[model samples]
Target: MILPEQFDQNELFVLTSLLIFYSLLFWLPNRFPLSLIILMMISSATVARLTDHLLSGSKMNLYSIMDLDKYELFDFFTYLLYAPFGYFLVYGYDKFKLQGISVLLYILVWALGATAFGEISLLFGVFKYKEWEASYSFTYYFIMISLMLLVYRFFKRSYKLHKVEIYNR
Candidate 1:
């Protein structure tokens, strides 16, 4: 059984925010195809969550677990908040169709967005940094966002390269 003390304001805020965002996403017409948007959300969330755990929870031990106490249910749920942001990232990238210096600028913008959110999270008691720094997060965001873009590109390319007849489905 879980204790009530485990769930706090930060976790609640994250959950409420995610719920509202998801509700909007479901009730509204999205910029990307429904399936593509869903795929990006899932892919980005999975990778971000996994990497976060490995970096902060295990390898670096940058911050204390969860609510600076233990790794509880609320902590895990908070990570889900990233899924919508991930969708937005992909959506922005796809909409721009950027190239040359524009692509570089776009990636930098997204990384800075991530950093801004990180700062907000810190202010909200979401994270407690130890050895980790903002520069580390910027680098991580740049690499992770770049990888996500590559994955999206590969997904698009594969579909184009292997077009199937309508009857094949």
Candidate 2:
């Protein structure tokens, strides 16, 4: 078990490859079916666990927060919130309703909305995690939200192109 600090080149490569593979797989699949998306999510989670174990020599518990006891209820609720955000974005885009800068603004709004909701819930004692510092929180939200938006855009474009090709054929 390599600790997080002990990630060697091989482990790093494996993790990086898995990330890229999952991202591409999720991004290229048309329809954005919930079942397929869930499968991809599970695969990514499994890979994350494996990477943690390989680096730390122990099973990684998703329930464990960086600085809090397991808040199973809130954790589940948060996942619920996140799922809809992803679903709606893809749905809107696929329907050709959302486009250009509007789509981007929507993504940013949703990201900030989710972050605010999470922070408020934490403040209200619904969950226990360290409050994110302003800079770190912004950066984290930017990366996560951008990743999801990019994947959705990729899938949307691919689906459109595939549809065009099929019609032409």
Candidate 3:
């Protein structure tokens, strides 16, 4: 069977599915500050998308399950799928306040979840790796999770410090 072009049925389904799945986050109460979550979501999504573009599109010229024929509109939408996932990563960590071994396990669980999602995407034609292995995605998720946790910690610390300074004044 021939695959549909960019903006085809499969792409639309994936995009719509992402939106619906992301919307589920609204039903849950957010433990972290809303402002912080939004900030992380925007920054993480933008940075992640750019990183993917640079590595997959430009540097490696890697193949994709989505149409990568010149970074079309649908391909851009697929990147958006990560925004809510990013939010949840920080949200879950902050909500639990995981530390020590707990933190390690938490991150590992999320990384594994991400890897599973990647596999699901591959099955659904959301991604077809070219010169890339699923194991590489697990590694990527681990690194991204680590960086995100560091960023969240730094942001939270800075915000607390700023609050203290303001109160002292």
User: Using Cα atoms with residue i matched to residue i, what is each candidate's TM-score against the true structure?
Assistant: 0.82, 0.48, 0.84
* lDDT (10s digit) by residue, model 3, range 1-169: 3344635556866877677868877876755666776778887778768776766775685656475446566666667777788888877787677899998999899999999987887776777677888788899889889899999888788878877321110
Winning model by TM-score: 3
Please identify model 1 stretches exceeding 4 Å from their true place.
Answer: 1-7, 31-35, 164-169
Relative to the unseen true structure, what is the C-alpha lDDT of residue 164 in candidate 1, on a scale of 0 to 100? 24
Q: Is candidate 1 or candidate 3 better by lDDT?
A: 3
lDDT of 1 by residue, 1-169 (tens): 2333656766766777779877866764466545566677888879877877877776677765346555667666666777877777766676667778988898999999898888777776777788878888899999988988888777666655776211111
User: What are the root-mean-square deviations of the candidates from the true structure over C-alphas?
Assistant: 4.0, 12.4, 4.7
Q: What are the per-residue Cα lDDT tens digits for candidate 2 across 1-169?
A: 1133333443343344346544654565355555535643543344433432343232433223212243333233333334434554454455555667987786677667656754654454433333334344455556666676576556546757766331110
**Residue pairs with backbone overlap in model 3:** 65-128
TM-score of 3: 0.84
Better of 2 and 3 by lDDT: 3
